[model samples]
Target: MKNLDLFDPRSVMDSDFSLNVSGGDSDFGFAFNDSNFSDRILRIEIMDDAPENRPDSEGCTSIADWARHRKRRREDIKKESVLDLTACPEEQILNCDQPDMEDCGDCGNPDEEAVAMSEESPSGDEAGNSNDSCWSMDSSTVVRVKTLHISSPILAAKSPFFYKLFSNGMRESEQRHVTLRINASEEAALMELLNFMYSNTLSVTAAPALLDVLMAADKFEVASCMRYCSRLLRNMPMTPESALLYLELPSSVLMGDAVQPLTDTAKQYLAARYKDFTKLQEEMMALPLAGVEAVLSSDDLQVPSEDAVYDFVLRWAKAQYPKVEERREILGARLARFIRFPHMSCRKLKKVLTCNDFDHDVSTKLVVEALFFKAEAPHRQRILAAEESATFNRRYIERAYKYRPVKVVEFELPRQQCVVFLDLKREECVNLFPSGRVYSQAFHLGGQGFFLSAHCNMDQQSSFHCFGLFLGMQEKGSVTFAVDYEFAARSKPTEEFVSKYKGNYTFTGGKAVGYRNLFGIPWTSFMAEDSLYFINGVLHLRAELTIRH
Candidate 1:
């Protein structure tokens, strides 16, 4: 019986009160003839027919029926009220029948609004009242009905829905009877929601029950109850099952800001649980669109490169949507934005243009955008990444890739040469502690592709842990090419690129060449703050390669 009053602070501190002084065990603490309430009746009609049993009831009996009923009921009531107003001006009609409450013309006359003893319907014309014609059009449709004496003023104070229904100058507003139609599944939740409107508390604490009440509150436009339910659900133990359920809530519920925190938490949980996409490929593929989006949206996903992410997205899309058109639509619309095109390999980007899964115009635009981003200067690219970070645009954000992105500037004048720049954040370099290797994206020189690799390994000469760098040809078992290459790095005090190694090698396909310990210092000293190497949390290295005649 946890009571959370999110709307009014006073309601939180106030003691709970019962609707009936007699302590009745009814669904709502409803008691007739009590002076503490108003002279109005709330008739909740429950349609208990199962979906398969009722021809008119759609498969979504609970939601579709409840929503259609609410909308149609309001419209019908307003239209009838307007007709009644036109037919009889300057007259307030109170249409109450039944034994517990009496109908009256004058609201101020207590004698006319007297309380009776029996529970029975009026006969003849009174029973065939035109006001109930629309609701009772299909008598068999309504399986059960529950009548309760409710205070319009009290309900209106808590929900705008009731306020508009009761105060909107409608004949139904002036009338003593108000009818609400809902399915049998909504019976308990609707009752809980009504009780909450009166007491600002809920007796149901379980997650599933609270969620049901939350949906009911949303249907009835009770913001406070939704917030209370969201808070209660958030406090309960969350599982992947429950998290996915929260994320998959109806769009109508998600539209409200009150449930946003709950969804955000769900997305975060899914993202963290599946941060390593490589390890959970099958599981991630099995996730629905929302869950996949949650995982891919995170900047923390661990993969080899953006190419792998693109592969996974394609595989998942293909598996989920065997139809080519639907697959293209989903990838182009929902999933494409999560793939960091700017960070993908050039070879992969080329393949993207020919990929049939993406719309031609969309894939072209993305490739052009990625190329433009790659063409920008290093500092300009950093600025763009920083700017896009504010909006959480995943295209510009770099994930933890096993192969880091690099910048390469090619030149034809120096006998076909290229200067490759590899910048590793201080933390990234730190992650290479003891013995770890990180490779850079491939660059082109002399019509051949090459890559830069950084490592932490035991120095062959000193037999101590030291930073290492290497140059490798992307091709394997191919024609050999002789090249002179130089490695340089920016150091403290000067912060200028200082040449470290100068050598020539006849590189065969699949062969690599470089010094084991380029810095010629122990790993600890090279990584120490105020060390000659790192500049402003970045380890900048440059490799210049020139084709030999």
Candidate 2:
């Protein structure tokens, strides 16, 4: 028997998923490919809404629209990772028209090479057919109320928990009886789990029992069952029901096996929807310190400004250490560790300093730093970073602060960013994003902040001696930024301004890529707008960072 690859749910969720939007076609169904399974999973035939089931408001829309509408109703497809395959490549498209069979090599996953279009469903007879062989290798064991008569070899093939029980010289390995501490309701799910172990196919009705069986499998160390359960929950919409379900699940069940279906995905949905996140603020605050820190450190926090973050932290700290009248400094400092103090505007810092609620050594130091940064201090004292913020960077979902005004701080981000400016004197690109790239006469952000650099791309044949944009950082060492910041060019007197461009990039560790011509023509306009200075070889460009997402 050939060994099978470990089951990866992402292959099913991330693979090119298509909805045939051909004119008035009701015969089309959804198809999915799973590398772990021998063949493609079942092609679910989308059923047309019956007259009684159809809502009066839709006005009998076309079948395609109705199908999509129905699919959306069943589950929110936001959790599903999708690639746009509407523009099928010539090599992948067998026929443009909605034909019986269509193979698309791209769209579902950026890395997928081929699309499996077969619709045939696998049968039980195909999975674990060697019953005699399985029986000869091992014996049956009674776990709890459920007595399973399975091929020891087949059961151990994928389940390390079973393999250990049967192989280790433990009491269970010698005896057939293996008692379990599971509930009565879990018996059915266990049976279904066994059936799936034997047969690749699991019935749709098994959804209700998925979580239960998943926990049991996890207890038994069945990696596949855990993945399947996570996929099922992740595949559900990020709606209240789904979010609540995920929240209610055991932390162990929700943690990452490979992909963090609950922890990361839920945070993503919440980040995208600010209102939802606010509503969960109380519950979010209740999470472990690390969890709350992770939530606060994201660039996609959807807050209007860093002010919101300060308020949130204050609320959480007050809740955690209520009546901090005596040890106010201690509690305040403890909670203040996560705030990107230097990211706050001068006005905000002033208000916070006088607020008495934040009268701590850390707050005083941050205010002093902000004042110095605003003054564009000639020498920064030290590169300061939010210790708590650094802990959040190693995971997905980057944390960013919003400081539209000339904000500067220590370079604590994980990825080192160097903004390359036109060293017109050398005819070579120099790292400039971190103004520190050029000591003396360079822009400084107090102790720790981003530096200016000319954006240029070699392959694209672009270069400019002008302005740059500011980027948000989760920490100093990050290779790329998750939050996008817009760079704009504006001048005084004439006040000529160019449209802002978003800097979307992934950087190599300690490396920087330039935005060579500042999104085309805009650079030319900015350079040419200040015509007198342009001729004099002098240009003043100001880049502002706008955190929209």
Give each model's whole-structure lDDT: 0.71, 0.40
lDDT of 2 by residue, 1-549 (tens): 113222222222222321121112222112112222222111211112334333311432332343333344333222211111223222111111211111423113312333454332224352233122111112222212222223344445546544544454432243322323222333455555666555533453333445545644654555655666777757765553344344444333323462356556766654454433446666666654445554564565644445567777777767766766733664464556556555554556777777666766657876786566445421121223223335553221223322222333334244322221211211112333212122111222222334344443222443434434333232346444333344554323354545446565543234443354453444334445444323223233444432223
Off by over 4 Å in 1: 1-35, 51-140, 253-255, 410-417, 443-450, 461-464, 473-482, 492-496, 507-511, 546-549
Q: Write the per-residue lDDT of candidate 1 for residues 247-301, one digit (tens) a residue.
A: 7665353338878888888899999999887797788888889999999999988
Query: Candidate 2, which segments miss by more than 4 Å at Cα?
Result: 1-144, 204-208, 251-255, 275-295, 316-338, 346-391, 394-403, 408-524, 527-549
Per-model C-alpha RMSD:
8.2, 21.6
Each model's total of backbone clashes: 0, 29
lDDT of 1 at 158: 56
- Model 1 accuracy (lDDT, Cα): 0.71
Best by TM-score: 1
